[model samples]
Target: MGKEFSSVPMYTESAEVTKSFDDDGRIKRTGTLLTASSHIITAVIGSGVLSLAWAIAQLGWVVGPAVLMAFSFITYYTSTLLADSYRCPGPVQGTRNYTYMDVVRSHLGGVKVQLCRLAQYGNLVGVTIGYTITASISMEAIKKSNCYHKHGHDAHCSEPAYPFMIIFAAIQIVLCQIPNFHELSWLSIVAAIMSFAYSSIGFGLSVAKVAGGGNNVRTTLTGTTVGVDLSGSDKVWRTFQAIGNIAFAYAYSTVLIEIQDTLKSKPSENKVMKKASFIGVTTTTIFYMLCGCVGYAAFGNDAPGNFLTGFGFYEPFWLIDFANIGIAVHLIGAYQVFAQPIFAFVEKSCQKRWPESKFINAEYMPFMGSHGFNMFRLVWRTIYVVVTAVLAMIFPFFNDILGLIGAASFYPLTVYFPIEMHIAQQKIPKYSFNWMWLKILSWSCLVVSLVAAAGSIQGLAVDVKTYKPFK
Candidate 1:
């Protein structure tokens, strides 16, 4: 990765410098509705969606699809509220808040900003860890799938996720060099396509199985029947855990304002972002409905965590392997999508705190284009990736981890912050209908998040007792 660049050059402004900047005096944000939607899709439809079948299986026919729709609606509505917060005081004329933290600090200044920062970044870190585990499992699935194709379906072909986790981390370390969310358009597009590819493949395979009529399809109205499937308490925990999984699938608001900051102020950033959210959430919901509903139909209560990678479809192993490949490739981009904000935060903070530090401020630019190479970014980002990969290896339980992350972050980042910001920004009356309903909604989500978190913790405890680390 060494570049033959000379010493750091002196800074000078030129006519050809394209010195245009956004209202915030940063680099011009050229992101369009399409690109914003692309970023949203990449963030929204990820390893989280791959587990929806299992979530649906837990919730069953009516509740499963209904929950998916409910989340889609909630996500879109809150996303619009978040969009307006991208600019304070006014939707278009107000000053821009660069990241989610900036939006919180602008509207709900105080410890609330720190709380938002913690939940936002903490959730981002947890998501990166979840992605590492999911991507490694996808990589391992390719190997196991090919083995099943060559040998018998019942053949022993399992492999440890450690090697694949390392591989995923290495790739993310390289991508972390992309610098910021504004520079990730191409990656977001590629990752969005990959998400759609794998989701479609999973949906198609499930539909095919249902049409085949060979496999026994078991189902229920309210989901896993009590006493028949498990004890009453187990059902309660799993049901709540499943809700967390669905919540995770709808999670993208942690970066919503960040993504909004990338838009050009024409028809207004808030307007564009709202449209993008509608498009993104609507498209994501369609995919979720198709994949989760049909996968549940195909396997009923026995639907695996991942229909493709969970050995639900052994025949036509090539397609399964391809879907798994899609998952890994998509996660390669999604990880960067989530990780870039953290990278930017830490780097910006260090530079702000130590403006005179050469290691933090100076950027070595190679002869090719305007890209700058900073030692701090390189080393720190690599360390971040490595730590997440290590954590993923230490705890590879996918569903439980996803549920935990989703439950931990869903309310504060997605629901509570946006509602509070909106109520403050719009100056909704204290005892007015809007304020009352908004408070009710936020409280309801908080309850759901807490219950789901408890369920995930219980599930993780159970898994930890039985599973050995690094296996």
Candidate 2:
């Protein structure tokens, strides 16, 4: 299992020599390990963490953390493979791949590159929708909690998720205007802090509840214990859903190369990325463990998909408001971080397709420099954000959207492609134990991802029929 790590070189000399310059002839790359790790953490720890209790309900206490840790390790390993895969043979020396699609184009050719783009775009868009849903739900929770505190049992909070979804979309529209990936580092830092803050609050609240007596728990249990004894096909499907949740929570590999491309030292960017990924994943995993375990213990089998909303009229209403605010803030940053690559791809694609278009050059516009807003940025991004917001308003099932994205995209992006690219880059023989094992791992991951995707799609279909748009 660890053989893959030893197979790929830490850094290629060609990557160190490659240089990218802006029109002004200044150094365009900028990132330290801390900023890089912050972005990775922001990308990895989004609204997905709020659903860890639902995943725990599927897998139980004994198996939940173990599976979560395993997925974390797998994601880290694949991310490193992806980081190393950026080095390819240039016309003179070797070229460094900057984007996810670039790596596929370099290794698998143009056909696979399109497929990779589809998956990458779909995953990012899915994540954006999930963020909107989560943010809207968080705002709704705060409103409900406040109303309950004021009016006791008769309080009724009538505000729906639709308006909040629109508000979240509007916030993202502004944040997404930040042009450079490296420039968003400060925003990522703030998002990371918010993630830690809310996670800590949830963990502390769950622990305090479990310590007091567990009488407020709403679910019937085997004896008052936390774990559920899952059996039959229901268990099977929930286990698959749990895998998707864990995978989605850790699925930040698509942007690894793009993030690495921002590092000042190209030669050591691979090592820097590996270090950042480890730190980010480890930190998120600890938070996940604390939140998931205590949340399940506090709620039992009846835990809601979104844990923050599941709290429902609890004491210390101010803390709930604070945590929900953190979630809303964090998602605003997370949306921009994930959506930047998609925006860049679209802009580049449009320029390529229409070379004579006035939007190609940022030279004439008043507020536009080389990295400033262009016509596509004003038109396409606005449309993209609005469309995504409408999707969120229509289908507001947070966990199901996550599961669908993870099942559809994670295996290919996180597991299969990285492993395949590693074997291809290293030219490892098919008969070799390392290659064989990686193939088996990739296939197993693919089968599981497919099952999770199927379950998510089925669940989503049912939700479509039963759930109202603005309710």
Candidate 3:
């Protein structure tokens, strides 16, 4: 008798398979769904949440929310447009897989790609430095306030304490190195809950203080009468600069590509992206409104400290303690997100330099060791912590460092990346531009990017010039 053959389907490379890895490289089944609310909550609640109120204070209550909302809309529109137009790279890869540079290279040629890469790298480094500074300062504030209370004045509490900072940085770095978004998703949720609680509590406290006949000196809105004196060209210039600053402050959609790649389903991913952005912006807008209303109402123009901190009637020690702890956690979360690209870039650079090193070998010295804890990550994190701690000690002023970092790092990532991606995607013949809107947005982005970059440079230069050794 002839051999009977049973019919069966054969699996092939082209067939869809379901498997995944988290940042820690633990394997899991694919097709998990992350909701829009969750994604938005995560995207919005980061280091910026604490600082946004302060940034708005410089403009006063009337202008702050307006600028924030407008900038948010512009950023949202641009980001969504870019996402829709560009062909984002595969899931497993990070943002480096198809950066703004890659898009430019595909459409605008290699030279532009190089330029974009340079810009991207500059932006990344600036952001890393900024986050580090924010994180270290936050930790220092917490340690000085809490640790000293728990310990004593004799306890070592100094800004140059790099070792402590390194430990915190390692925690952040490891959280970031987790290969999967599933684990990190919880971070956003926790941050959002804390942020909302803080903002609500802070706002209530500020309002109560104002209502109870606290110092509430109002400032005149007129330009000439006040020292602002924005008359003629100077007025126009300041407005332009303010707009640029606004754009820099609000443009945070640079992570869209990564967010898109992280999602398992295309439709869900797009929905989450939009939802996250909307939630983030809306939450921010509300917080700004509440803070501005109550803050300005209480402290007015002569607000004693940074407007955010100064608004409330609480004692300095109390406010600082709460802020310190909250900000520390938020900053650590941010560091995790930001560090992914930095580590990836380092790995890529190392691989390029030593082609025969077999550095990519899984069995080789892991970028982070097999277990989440290791010396390799510890060393890199220590370096990051030390550099930032040193900067904090030298600068000693949070507002200036924040502004410098905001302009240098956040501005480019938020403003430049979207526009560049938009322009790059325009090269596709089928893509059409809304001539009027495009022109306006393009000009706006260009002007804002230039101003922010210039401002950042000036701010950094001022820091350098004013530098004195910490006592």
Q: Give the TM-score of candidate 1.
A: 0.96
True-vs-predicted CA distance for residue 236, candidate 3, Å? 9.7
Give the TM-scores of the predictions, in the order they appear. 0.96, 0.89, 0.74
lDDT of 1 by residue, 50-74 (tens): 8898999888888889988988888
Q: Any runs in candidate 2 off by more than 4 Å, and if so which?
A: 1-26, 89-93, 216-233, 363-371
Model 1: clashing residue pairs? none
- When summed lDDT is taken over every stretch of 10 residues in candidate 1, the lowest stretch is 6-15
* Per-residue accuracy of model 3 over 1-471 as CA lDDT, tens digit each: 122222111233344444544332323313223433444444454445444444444456567567667676776776665454335432123222334455555445656666666666665555555556555655565556555556665666554535545666567645644643445566755655656665665576667667778464664342112344333543333333344444434535544555554554434444555656666677766775676456556655444333333323334455656765665666565555555555556555654575444223122234444423333334555566456556545555444444444555444455555555555454433335554556566666556556655654554565578666554
Off by over 4 Å in 1: 1-19, 367-369
* 108-167: candidate 2 lDDT, tens digit per residue: 785777788888988888888888888899988888888888888465666688888888
In candidate 2, how many Å is residue 192 off?
0.8
Worst 10 residues of 3 by lDDT: 1-10
Give candidate 1's error at residue 274 in angstroms: 0.4
Please give the RMSD to the true structure for each candidate, in Å: 2.5, 7.7, 8.2
Q: Number of clashing residue pairs in every model? A: 0, 1, 8
